[model samples]
Target: MSYKEFLVQLSEASGVSGYEGEVSDVIKKAFKEIGHEVTSDNLGNLICFKKGKNPKGRKIMLAAHMDEVGLMVKDIDANGFIKFTTIGGVDQRTLLCQEVIVHGKEKVYGIIGVKPPHLTTPEERSKPLEIDNLLIDTGYDFEEINKLVEIGDVVTIKRQVYNLQNNHIAGKALDDRVGVAILYYSLQELNKLQHDVDVYFVATVQEEVGTRGATTSAFKIQPDIGIAIDVGFGKTPELNQFDTIEMGKGPAFTVGPNIHPGVFNHLKTTAKDHYIPYQVEVAANHSGTDAWPMQVSCSGVATGVISIPLRYMHTSVETVNLSDVEKSGKVLAHFIASLNDENMEELLCY
Candidate 1:
């Protein structure tokens, strides 16, 4: 399948953080299509492995979280209006006037509602409304709504995945699902290349919450090298000019303490040697991606991070360039193909 098709299937699915079953199915199906078997762990991580020429040589893992930031039903008011709590790091500003799908007994469409501005004082209009004041209007009152919806049910913004003027994709859940798409494309590309180290691809869960899924998966896999694929801040006028990466230029390769010097060097060299367009990013302390936990897994691991530049993260309209996703996967496949015992040892001795 094409990258857009793969990403759309994942982006449209209701796979909120800590509730990634739907996303799991999509990944499993894609892996099956590519002739790889997928397995899930107790905490809901989906794993796929492609052994290298020497299966026992070195092991490397690539991870991309499958969870998306969403909301959970917190309370059902007397009139059946729904009150909800933010699931991951949902911005309060984006919650108003949103179209959401309540995942209760079935998918129920609803819109976020609040006090009418005409009836409100000028002070209220001047301030951002708190989440506590937002209510979901599901067109059902009391008894009828209670039957179809309940407390604790998940809610996701209803959004349609679409393309932009320059092959850019805009939608919800692209935060890491696009990373997963990169994994899919990488595996497809690997089918054409020969490599010497075993590769493990993990679709981790709960990254939006605390990088929890990668924490456990890394501990279990204990690979010699690990790479986390995630999204970086896309350049916008609102952001500091030097802080965000340009959207269409290329994927950003992270560098700093959280990243092993060896792994970073390998990624950098691969991009340069193969002429894959890429940018450099710095993470002073922790990168806030799955790479953070993967670095400290078990007896410690050599880890690196590669990010696809994205805009409006944690909101309904996250955006990414399709070329960036394709190139990220392409560069990663080449990086993996370049691995061998001699080079790996040389990289790590630093």
Candidate 2:
């Protein structure tokens, strides 16, 4: 499938933290066509394994989270306004007056309700809007809304993918859904490779709340090398150069506490050897991807992170460049093909 098709399918799916069944099913179908041996962990992480040409080869794990940030219903007021709490980090300023889809009885549509400035005092208008004060309006009475909606139902922003000028794409859930697409496409390309390593393409869950899925999946796989594919911040007009990378340039290789030094160097060398365009990202502490937990799992696996630069992260209208997405996949495919027993030893040193 084309990247555009994958983006639409991934963005439209509802897979909040701990609720990844639907997304896992979609990904399993895609991998099955490529002849991968697919299975799921007890925690619902989808693991697709491909046998290598060399029998006693190193085990490599490639991880991409399947979950996205969303809200869960907390209460329903008498006027049918729904109160909610965020499942992940969400900016309250962006929640006001936006359309949302409440995954209740049958996917009810609603809008985030906010107090108009006309009704607010001058001091209140200048202060930040508290999350507790916001509610969702579904145009129903309390009794009627209660019949269709209930507490703990997932709620996601209602948005569709669209193409922008300068080769940028915008939509919701690109934070990690784009990572899933990259991993799937890379595995498809890697199926043609003659390698000496056992590869596992893992679709993890609950990364937004915490790297819960990766933690459990890595413990089960016990791979020698683990690589996490996720979205990173792209340079925008409002963001400083130190905080983000340029969009459409290429994928970013993260240098951080969570990533293994040798794995990081190998990724850079592999990208250069394959003539793939890539950038470097510096993260002094935790990388904040699945790599964080995967690194320390089961006697400490070699971990690294490859990120696709995305703009306006965690918002309904996240943006990414298609060229960067494809380049990331190529880099991963090449990296997997270049690994072997000797290189695996080198990776273990750092």
Best by TM-score: 1
Q: For candidate 1, what is the lDDT?
A: 0.92
Query: Which stretch of 10 consecutive residues in model 2 shows the poorest summed lDDT?
Result: 1-10
lDDT by residue for model 1 (302-342), tens: 99999999999988899999999888998999999999988
Model 2 residue runs over 4 Å out of place are none
Whole-model Cα lDDT per candidate?
A: 0.92, 0.88
Every model's TM-score:
0.98, 0.96
